[model samples]
Target: MRLERAVDDFVVQLASERGLSANTAKAYRSDLDALAAFAGGRGAHDTSDLDLELLRDWLWQDSRSGLAKSTIARRSAAARGLTAWLAREGHTTADAGARLRAPKADQHLPRVLTRSQVDGILDSLAALAATGDPVAVRDVALIELLYASALRVGELVGLDLGSLDRSRLTVRVTGKGSKDRVVPFGVPALRAIDEYLATARPKLAARNSAEETTAIFLGARGKRINSRTVYQLVASLLADLPGTGPAGPHALRHTAATHLLDGGADLRAVQELLGHASLGTTQLYTHVSAARLKDTYRVAHPRA
Candidate 1:
C-alpha cells in the first residue's frame, strides 16, 4: 500500500479496533506522516520500500534535528507499532521497524505539591466557593475531586451525572483506552461535590437545553466541559506555586499519588487507584516520595 494511505489505515485501526485514545492516535499520525515524508523524499514511494535501515535513518534524522530523546523514542515506537501492524495484517512481508531503537526517554520527576500548599489551595477555593457563584462553586468541586481522586482531566470532563455513586463517595471514570474504574474521594471532596450538585450544577445546567443536563461538569455555556478548560483551571491554580514541571491537571494527579505514597499507601493499591496498567508505571511515585524524604532528612538531620 502507498505509505500515506497505509498510515491512515493504521491510525484508523488504532482508534477503532485497538481503542487507542484520540490524542494517542493523533500522535501516531504525526509521527508516521513525518516518516512517510522522509521516505517520499528518498524516492521510496510505498510501504514496501520502507526498511529497517530507513526507520533507523528517521530516528537519526530526528536526533540530528535536535528533537528531545523522549520525542525521538516515541517516534520510533510509533513507527514500530505501525510496521508491526502492517506485517500482522498481511500488508507487509516483514516488520520494517522491528529492529529500530532510540535513546531512552529522560524521566523527570513530576511536580508535587507539599501538604500545606494543597491545604492552602483548597482553603482559597473554599473561600471563593462561599461567594455563591455557581461557576466558583463548580471550580471548587472540580479541583477537590481532581486532587482527591487523581483523575485525568479527560476523565473528569467526560464524567456524567450517572457516573457518581454518591452514597459511596466514588466516581466511575472512563480512563484512557475507554477503561472504567471506580475511584473514591475524601470527605472534603464529597462536601464540595454536594454543594456544587445542590447549588451550582443545576444552575449551570438550566442555562442550556435539557439534552445537556447529563454532564457532571459544565462549561460557561452549560455544555459538557472540555479538557482544555480543565487545563486552564489547574494552570491558574498552580501558577504561583514553586514548581518546574507542567502546571496542568496531571500535576494534581502526581501530587495526589506522591501524597498517598508518603502517607504509607501500598504501592500495588496505588497502582490500581491510579489506573496504571503496569506496576512499573505507578512506581515512579516511589521515586518522588524517596526524593522528598531525602530532602526532608537533609534539612532536619543534625548529622551532616
Candidate 2:
C-alpha cells in the first residue's frame, strides 16, 4: 500500500476506533503528512519502503532542522503508532519504527498565580460585571467557574444549560475522550453563574431570532463561545501578570490545582476534580507547590 494511503487509514482508525479528540487526530495527521512528504522525497513511497532506517533518517533530519524536542517526540510517537498499526493490519511485514526514539521534551513548570493575584483578577472582573454589560457578566462567570473547578477550556465551553446542578453546586462537563464528570464549584462561582444566567445569557441568546443556544456560555452573536474567544479573554486577563508560560485558560487551571494542593487538598481528590487520567499528571502541581515553598523559604530565611 502507498504510504499516504496507509497513513490516512491509520488516522481514521485513531478517530473511529480509538476515539481520540479531533485536535489529537488533526495533530497526528499533520505529523504523518510531514513524514509522508519526507519519505516520498527519499524514494520510500510505499508501505514496504518504510523500514527502520528510513524512519530513523526522517526523525534525524527533523532533529537537524532544529524543531523543538517536543515536536520531534510527538512526531516519533505518531510514526510508531502508524507502523505498529500497519504491521498489525498486514500492510507491513513488521513494525519497522517500533524501536525508534526521540529526545524527551523538557518539562517547564506551569505558570501559577498567587492567591492575591487571583483575588485581584476576580475583583476586577466583578467590577466590570457590575456595569451590567452582558458580555462582561458572562466573562466574570466564565473565569470564576474556570478557577473554581479547574476545568479545561474545552470543558468549560462545552457546558450546556442543563449541565449545571445549582442545588448541588456542580456542573457536568464532557472531558477528554468524551468522558463525563461532575465537578463542584464554590459559592463564588455559583453566584457569578447565577448572575450570568439571570442577566447576561438571555440577552446574548436573543441575538439570533430563529434559534436558541443551549450552551452555558454564549458569544456576542448568540452562539456557543469558541475556544479562541475564551483564549483571548484569558490572555488579556493574564497579560500583565508575572509569568513566563502561556497566558491561556489553562493557566487558571494550573493556578487552581496548585492552590488546592497548598491548602491541603488530597491528591486523589484533586485528580478527580481536574479529570486527569493519571495521578502523575496531577502530581505536577505538587512540584509547583514545592518550588513555591522553596522560593518563599529562600526569601524569608536569614540563616542562609
RMSD in order of candidates = 1.2, 1.0
Off by over 4 Å in 1: none
lDDT by residue for model 2 over 132-251, one digit each (tens)? Answer: 999999999999999999999999989999999999999999888788999999999999999999999999999977887789999999999999999999999999988789899999
Position 129, candidate 1: lDDT: 82
lDDT tens digits by residue: candidate 1, 1-304? 9999999999998899878888888899999999999999988888899899888888899999999999999999999998999899888899888888899999999999999988988899888888898999999999999999999998999899999998999999988888889999999899888899999988888888757568899987788989999999889989998878999999999999999999999999999889999999999999999999999999999993
Q: What would the TM-score be for candidate 1 when compared with the true structure?
A: 0.97
Candidate models: Cα lDDT each: 0.91, 0.94
> Residue 195 in model 1: shift from native, Å?
0.3
Task: List TM-scores for all candidates, in order.
Answer: 0.97, 0.98
Q: Check candidate 1 and list the clashing pairs.
A: none
Error of 2 at 110 (Å): 0.6
